[model samples]
Target: NAGVTQTPKFHILKIGQSMTLQCTQDMNHNYMYWYRQDPGMGLKLIYYSVGAGITDKGEVPNGYNVSRSTTEDFPLRLELAAPSQTSVYFCASSYSGGGYGYTFGSGTRLTVV
Candidate 1:
């Protein structure tokens, strides 16, 4: 089964263009999160959802948005994308917290210029 999947593995955005980073899971997990990784830094949570129809913003949600329409999907939307938003976007899910670790997708590398 596909634990997690992310579309458009690599993309380049114009100064103001926008795109949606797609994420899907087949494990039926209840906790899903969107995180962005930068060089030499740890992942920063952008948004999360406990379950379908319940979404929340995370530490770095300013330049992004997210929605959890179903248990197996959590998509991230970037509106009026900016250069500061350039980073590797990762989609993850877990049945529980850190004790169980997390299943993450390969990540979508985004570049804005």
Candidate 2:
């Protein structure tokens, strides 16, 4: 499988601007997730979807939104971005078990100025 891929590896947005971090996978995973990794900190879940039409908010869902319309795509939308939203975003996909451990994307580094 091709695993997961994210676009705009790096980005710098103004305080009120917005952006969409694209994500896709070829593994036919049933679960997709969005997470943010702060410097020297652990990953915090932003949003997740168990399957198509089953999206939900995660630990740090503020200033962010997501949708999983298909098995391959789960894009994260940042609206009215703030400085606190500046962080490394990652997209992951898994086949619905702990054993799979999820496949992570290269990551999208965003800086909300």
Candidate 3:
């Protein structure tokens, strides 16, 4: 579907390396979020933005960064890759932060060695 697209479906990173997980949505949702899911664990929110140029940290924002430059793009950046950061990253968007449903990207599987 053209709802949300995440690039680089799989990646392997060395310690101290960095990468950006690209996320884009065609639905023009105003609320975007970056989340990571570890094995046997629930999804942890990393970052979120309500609109363009506005962002806030979520539950787990230690090793990640996010920017919402426009309504369609919200990229999550890993400054220094760590083994603990290895997880499946997901991007989701919603029309609003209330009870509205969200459209989620496939996911980006990252492994930091």
Best by TM-score: 3
Q: lDDT per residue, candidate 3, 2-70, as tens digits?
A: 999999899999999999999999997999999999878899999999999999999999988888889
lDDT of 2: 0.92
In candidate 1, what residue range of length 10 has the lowest lDDT sum? Answer: 93-102
The Cα error of candidate 3 at residue 75, in Å, is 0.3
Cα lDDT tens digits, model 1, 48-80, are: 888899998889999788888899989999999
Superposed on all Cα atoms, model 3 deviates from the true structure by an RMSD in Å of: 0.9
RMSD for each model, in Å, please?
A: 1.0, 1.1, 0.9
Residue-level lDDT of model 2, residues 1-113, one tens digit each, is 66899998999999999889999999989999999999788999999999998998889898888888898999999999999998999999989945779889999999988
Candidate 2: worst-modelled 10 consecutive residues by lDDT: 94-103
TM-score for candidate 3, please give it: 0.97
Model 3 weakest 10-residue run by lDDT: 95-104
Residue 79, candidate 1: how far off, in angstroms? 0.4
Candidate 1: lDDT of 29? 90
Q: What's the TM-score of each model vs. the native? A: 0.96, 0.95, 0.97
Instruction: Please give the CA lDDT of all the candidate structures.
Output: 0.92, 0.92, 0.94
Model 2 segments more than 4 A misplaced: none
Better of 1 and 3 by TM-score: 3
